[model samples]
Target: MDSVQVRPMQEDDLPSAERASAVTFFEAERSTRRVSDPEAEPRSAAASKQWIDRMRFYLSVDPAGCWIAVDEEAGANRAVGFAISQNRGRLWFLATYGVLPSHQGQGIGKRLLDAALAHADGRPGIFSSSVHPGATRRYRMADFSLHPQMRMVGTVDRSTLPVVDGLQEGQADDFAWMDQLDQDLRVAAHGPDHGYMLDILRLVVCRDGARPGYAYLDDRGRASLLAAAHPETAQKLLWEALASSQGPTLVNCITTPNEWAIDVGLAARLDIGQEGYIAVRGMPVPAPYLASGHFL
Candidate 1:
């Protein structure tokens, strides 16, 4: 055991921080028996690349919001915990936070979080949080309101798939209107984040009549992010997402504000389960919207 110090995360710390995060989350889930295969490695190559890329993007955009805890013993200065956050206009979001199980309960997480919160600068803040008791306690002590989040996962019933219409492939040109929809719902436009998301996810959009909505789906047809002007439009976009899936689908980050998503998932015969929290400060849960865990 050694003294740990919390400091700004450097570009060089990405790999070690990524490992710390992955191991911490895996261990947390394993403790709850939520991990189906305990023998599987926590981070796959593709997932590591995605995480490192995101950390690089955050470091470039808001270096002040990224911090890492390092074991300061001689020859042991490795990252043991980390927190990454980002600010979009008046909104601040916690991108990721984790403390290695080996270093848990030593106040390293709190120190890292305090460092990260400094970047919020009094703006409204939000994050998708795992259902870890210690983490929940910390968020509550920081004055965040935790809204229980639900997730629907399973193979879609193809026979029940409806004829969803009005959705077309989205492009870079659609960013402006999509940003407006973002602002209308969450009080901030996901300006730069939209570009990042567009790089990796397929965007499906609906602009029919007065109902304008957009959803970003992964190759698996899981909705990573979605927002709309009306509940009906939101439901239509969700149904379209499910209908387009090639196999099992996931629709996560569903708060009480977005029951339309639950309806669509249920119609497709997806099973529902409680997962985490949409913790927020100074704002209500966004309705008719499903938030991105990384970008929220």
Candidate 2:
């Protein structure tokens, strides 16, 4: 373990970091009781590519919070683990973290987490949605309390939704508006370069002539209700997103704090899937709307 070195991640290290994340995550899930749908297709290449994009996005916003663990004995300083974190106002989040399966039990992950927490510096709240039980346990040991959650999946039939007036499709140009909304609603400024998000998801907004809310849905139909000025706006935006998506649409990290979020999930006919836990330390901040499982 002493042969491993921890340092801030460079842009060049992202590809390998993504690969390490995939292997570690896949192997970790396989070790658990979590079952996969037998009829489901093998993991998609696009899914793998999405991890790379997400890591890059997190890095773009919080470069200092990203770290990589390398095995110095490997000569090339091979990356064996990594962590991506961000401070969204008072809410600090561990966006993602993983150690290569082969490198487990060697303290690399601890070092990476230590670096992330040091950067966080006991911020009011730090959060994560942990996929693997081992990860949940690790976070628990780190003094983070756990909240149960799930991946809710269902058919999103837009036909069932009454046409909400003033709702319009959003574009890349709406990045600034969305960032401002995020700051106002969540007290977090996620920055304004989200134009890149439209490249990966369908951006939709509910504008009461003044931008009440927005949502993002990818090609595969995974949708996230980013933020809403109020419960009614959140409902409308959620309905709009559900109306527009296809296949097995998903919303991750739904908790008891938001009755409207849960009601919308039920109204959309989303079925509860594999359970996960959101771990948080410090202040208990409410997250009625989450952008994605990976982000929160």
Q: Whose lDDT is greatest here?
A: 1
Cα lDDT tens digits, model 2, 232-279, are 887777776667667767777666665676677777777777567667
lDDT of model number 2: 0.71
Tens-place lDDT per residue, model 1, 1-296, is 44788889999988888888889988887775555534535768899899999999999988999998988772355889999988889899999998989888878788888888888889899999988888998999999999999999889999998887788999999999988888888979999899999999999999764789999998888889999999999998898888878876789999998888898889889999888899999988998899999887
Q: Residue pairs in steric clash, candidate 2?
A: 158-243
Name the regions of candidate 1 deviating beyond 4 angstroms: 34-41, 74-76
Clashing pairs in 1: none
Best by TM-score: 1
Question: What are the clash counts of all predictions, listed in order?
Answer: 0, 1
Q: Which ten residues in a row have the lowest lDDT in candidate 2?
A: 33-42
TM-score of 2: 0.86
lDDT minimum window of 10 residues, candidate 1: 32-41
lDDT measured at residue 124 in model 2 versus the true structure, 0 to 100: 48
